[model samples]
Each structure stands twice: as structure tokens, then as C-alpha cells.
Target: MTKSVGALTVRTDPTLKEVVVDGKDMSVYVFAKDTKPGVSSCDGECATQWPPVPAADAEAAKGLNQELLGSITRADGTAQLTLAGKPLYYFAKDTMPGDVKGQGVNDTWYASAPDGWKAGVKRQALGVLDHPKLGKILQDKNGRTLYLFTKDEPWR
Candidate 1:
């Protein structure tokens, strides 16, 4: 169960908790960010580094400010959480609380608006490099820009 203070509510999950950063207690939200639109922008071995954060039990987050939360479908048919219509995500490199090593990472990965990284947060987001192209980022190593490997159907 979550507790609220005034217009702000503390989001609680077994995995997320309230921690102080710069002396302010902010709720840590877990989700993905958009490199662009429609088509996802991460792929290849890079995907292993910043794997998209999936909703644990899509149904687990029902009701509770339905207006503030939602999801968008990815090209891979997976749902990404949307807060105020923007998809949310977490950086795999953020190994511990208060580590925003992913913010402004490569001009690709970003902290989701409205419910992500708090002020004074430091992020090194490098996942945007992995998502398949929604538009087109510059070429990476191997002279490749964007790539995705189709799973053997029955898919998986």
C-alpha cells in the first residue's frame, strides 16, 4: 500500500522505496524513456546492458491515478509504462539507490518526465544506444546505426 502527502503521493513497490537525495524525499519511479516514437531505439549486445524495464505484473498497477499512468506498445509487442503519456524506464547501470548515472546519457537515454530522477540527481543513462531506431541516431561501431534480431518464432 502507498501513502500520500498532500497532492504528492509516494509510489511504493517491493522493489522501489523512498530515499533522500539532496535532503528531499522523492519517490523513485521505474519505467522506460522514448528515443523518439513508435519504433523502439535499442538493440544488439547493447540491449544486454540497458535491457528495457518491463512492468512486473501489468495488472498490478491498476486504478491509482489512472489518469497519470498508462503504457505504449513497443515494436517487440512489449508494453512500456507511460506517465502523463510519456514512457518511463530505469538504467541497468544504476546499481544502487540515489545513483542517477544515466541522466542525459549519450543524448539518448533520459529520465522520464514528471516521475523520474529528482533534482540533484546524477545519471549516466547509456541505454538509448540499444533501442532500435524510431528516427535515427548516428552510426555506432561496425558502421551500424540501428539493428534488431528477430527471435525464432514461437518467438521468445
Candidate 2:
């Protein structure tokens, strides 16, 4: 179950916790072109497609971190909820609770993480690459190579 803190909430994904708005499966997004931190660049037509996440009531936060939660005043003077200074938004096509249609739209928009981080797609390796010093290196299904640093500790 997702833990609700006022109008905002947190949902667990495989790698990290995601922010959900309005207690629904709606995943919030951040625009890459939003040059101004703590302010939303999406407005007018853009705002119609990506609706801003409304701020939670002043006294209502359940499991969300208070420090990372905040609000920003939009051009229309409406207050919208912000996480880690990034304004949150919802996708239009996500009609269901668990829809992630907005995960990586336009390479500019992405699902918002609880820590105000952006999630990346996980790729599977199909073959290996011949490295000069590293020898044979693992490559993803798309030919992207990956590396394991010697300084990294083993997973427990």
C-alpha cells in the first residue's frame, strides 16, 4: 500500500520510491525545460496536458518527508505542490491508478522519485564487448556496454 501524507504519497518501485498525487496511481512528472528551480515552466497548453500536482493541506502529511515538501505559486496565482524544489505534474493519458505512460516522454519529461530524482530504464545485456584493458565487457540488448568498478563492494 502507498503511504499518504496529505495530498501527496509515496509508492515503492523496484529500485526506488515514487511520488503519487491525489492518492491515486497517478505518477508525477518533471519537465526538463523547467529552467527555474521551484517554479513550473508548463503552462497554457502544456499545463493542459501535464496538470500540476496540487499542494497538500498545511496540517496533513502522513509518511512524506516534510523537508522535501513545498509549494510554488503558478502564473495564475494557484499554489502547486513541490518536491525537492521541482514542481510536480500529472500525465493526461494515465487514466488508471498504475499507469506510467509518462515515464520517459520526449526525453524531457519523466516520472518523479520521492527524493526528487529521475528514474531511468533498465536494460538487459545480450552479449559482450572486447575492451582493450577491461577485456570482455557486458553489453545490453541494445549494444550499450556496462562496467563493474573494482572499488565497489559486493552485494550482501
lDDT of 2 by residue, 8-67 (tens): 565666553454445655677777888685578999999889988777562224545556
Please give, for residues 101-138, the per-residue lDDT of candidate 1 as tens digits. 66556655544323332323343432122222232333
* Residue 61 in candidate 2, Cα distance off native in Å: 5.8
TM-score of each: 0.43, 0.65
TM value for model 2: 0.65
Global fold similarity of model 1 (TM-score): 0.43
Worst 10 residues of 2 by lDDT: 1-10
**Cα lDDT for residue 121, candidate 2:** 40
* All models, RMSD in angstroms: 16.1, 10.9
- Using TM-score as the measure, the top candidate is 2
**Model 2 bad stretches (over 4 Å):** 1-7, 14-21, 56-63, 121-156
